[model samples]
Target: MSKIGVVLLNMGGPDSLSAVEPFLYNLFSDHDIIEIPRLIQKPVARLIAKLRAEKTKHYYEVMGGKSPQREQTEQQAKALQNVLGENYKVVVAMRYWHPFTEEALRELFTEDISKIVLLPMYPQYSKTTTGSSFNEFERVFKRFPQVPVIRIISYHNHPAYIRAMVENIKEHLQSWESYFFLFTAHSLPVQVIKRGDPYKDQTEETVKLIMEHFPEVSYALGYQSKIGPVKWLEPFTDKLIEELIKSGVKRLALIPVSFVCEHSETLYELDVQYKSLAESLGVESFVRIPTLKDHPSFIEALRQLVISSLQ
Candidate 1:
């Protein structure tokens, strides 16, 4: 008869343009994300953040001067809380920005909870995403070892999750026959994959699972949002768009398979940048299947994961 705590983990974004630099600093400072030696990480992070802040701020400005991810994740938390009812308290623990994992743990420790569930917003597992968040959690959790923790690592192939994505995609499609599906995920450096990260494989598996429902539909997987000049998971999404357009594929449907919420990557990169690129290449129609943000099925999927973890 004790309360359960559910903490949703995500890579938080700046709430406003002013917060952009610090957010970037926090992100780059994380050793799990930007691999730098402990001695010079902060200095390098500061320099990188300073260099990128203006351009990054412009990206956010184009998307209404802030990232919608925090709001979307909070709404998802509320929805999940409602689904779980009074017995569970759901909160978000963002890795890089405000409402950070430290803050989330502080709030949950104050609650009369019996156990805590650490659920990453990412469906696919990657050291840079879920692993980074978990590392932060473990650092903060040292303060409250008495409260048992249950970690739901990637649920990439979870039936409920796959069903939610499939359902969302189905609802958005006018006719599956006319559109060429492109499954695009946030790209990681190729070095990360070589280091034994399961991200690439898991992402591919998620796409494979979702595509099972649309056997006849033409689809290809691509990677987007690569940082710096490092070789990332290929083929790059922008290049893929060009390839498809040149190949006589005029109508395309882009699916952000790795993301569960709308953020800069989806809103600006996919919606504006990629859309513009596709249009410039004479793509007749470019549709982006929306991320499953608090969709009823997605909420149900979260609820099921929590319930199963409890048992």
Candidate 2:
């Protein structure tokens, strides 16, 4: 039997504080991110990375000098591998850091795999996430086009994924009373949307589907992780939290909707930074629903996605 390769894609984070700068340089250098001419973007990306490296290092320092994304992603990859059986090989491909897509592709090319399944870890399709990863994958896989590639673009509304998210949320919340739900997604620059990115819409769809499972739960949607002066999707999660607090909402539940696994954004950004913000705003309870990393239903969803793609 020919080996089936399953490639899981994600925006890889720096493994340690020292690698953060170069990782940022790689990230900002990507056309999908900076969206400028190569010559100009390269130097600009370097400058930005150099300027931000110190501050970014502090973030990693607080999180124990590294990001947990690679570990968490490996956990998901391992789970998928187990479910897919011995004949299947699962690869974890990160966009900007170690074990990059190129490395994964090279490794797979040497293997006895007959076909490749590209399953992006991002549940929603976005030019920045899945699109970027696909673009890179295509560029590398050009060398082995004979090995057919099946891509699963997005599974934002997949039943198993939605169920896993709902279950994770229910498992986290100690009580449903007096708490309002906030479905938070990572924010993208407004210009990205103007350029016809469907990320926001797909994220909304995910929210709507999850909302269906909680008709009695009062919930709202917002964006997070905005950087720089650029106008990002609004109302921002922090501002929305403030609004909820001013409106006499004492308890708040936050769900990192776009993220399927815990990373710096969830741990440092939402848990540490946003938690502090919520407390300062007089929020009595700030509950952040965990990401769906290695959840049985989520792994099942990945299996289904691969099965459908192979067909």
Candidate 3:
């Protein structure tokens, strides 16, 4: 059989509080996620993971102590397989959580797979997310003598992706009026920006395209979920919201553009905490738009990406 396999990659979150430490350990140990020098990588990684796990668990607990990443990725994988026709098999592979990259790679070994494709759900090319997943994947593949020859579908920032995002915004915004079109993506530390990571720039470009597509979006593009004192992209979403309230903007429509599937960040951090903060600041209305999962354009984008990679 001329086997063709697609590995759908993502940064996985813990499913429970007990899993938090190990989950974060995997995330922190990756040089792509945290650049602790090789000399003290293990020790520093353990320490950071242990520390961050506590706070991260709180975020998860607030949103029912888990994230929908695994299920969402599985759904996407099934959908992609359908779109790619019955021949292409796609596997959900995560960096830190369940259906781990190692496990996914092992699954490939059992199959008659020859040509494989790597697909990161992340639209933005970030060393911290897609790069990190690929780095781990390479590590796993090196263990095998004849690793299935693979081609990678790099970030597909095509017009279809932009249209999917814009369509979601337009559909959701139809019900609201006089609200700020707040575009929020996952935040990367400022150090990454200084180190020449293109995540920030790519995000900004997406914002530009969305704006071009929808001229009515008086949106402010900002980053969210920055941890620690290390400077992150600003104006940060929370700070931006507060600033907007101060500037007399009473209504807001926030969308987590970086996240295509709902997660703790979107559920609790944005929905609950940010909503509470906005309410306290005397803002009358604050709503968060859901991610565009199973949206026709998004699935079509994935299908196009897979087909393009195959050829």
Worst 10 residues of 2 by lDDT: 139-148
What tens-digit string does per-residue lDDT give for candidate 2 at 66-152?
989999999999999999998899998999998988788777766688888999989999989999999998887776647878889
Q: For residues 254-308, could you state the per-residue lDDT of candidate 3 as single tens digits?
A: 9887887888778888998889988999998887888877787888888887787
Clashes of each: 0, 0, 0
Model 1 weakest lDDT span, ten residues long:
140-149
Give candidate 3's error at residue 275 in angstroms.
Answer: 1.1
Off by over 4 Å in 2: none
Candidate 2 lDDT for residue 75:
98
Clashing pairs in 3: none
Candidate 1 per-residue lDDT, tens place, 1-311, comes to 67899999999999999999999999999999888798999999999999999999999999999999999999999999999999988889999998998788778767788999999999999999999999999998887747888999999999999999999998997887789999999999999999999999999999999989999889999999888877889999999999999999988999999999998899999999999999999998899999999999999999999999988
lDDT of 3 at 310: 65
TM-score of each: 0.98, 0.97, 0.93
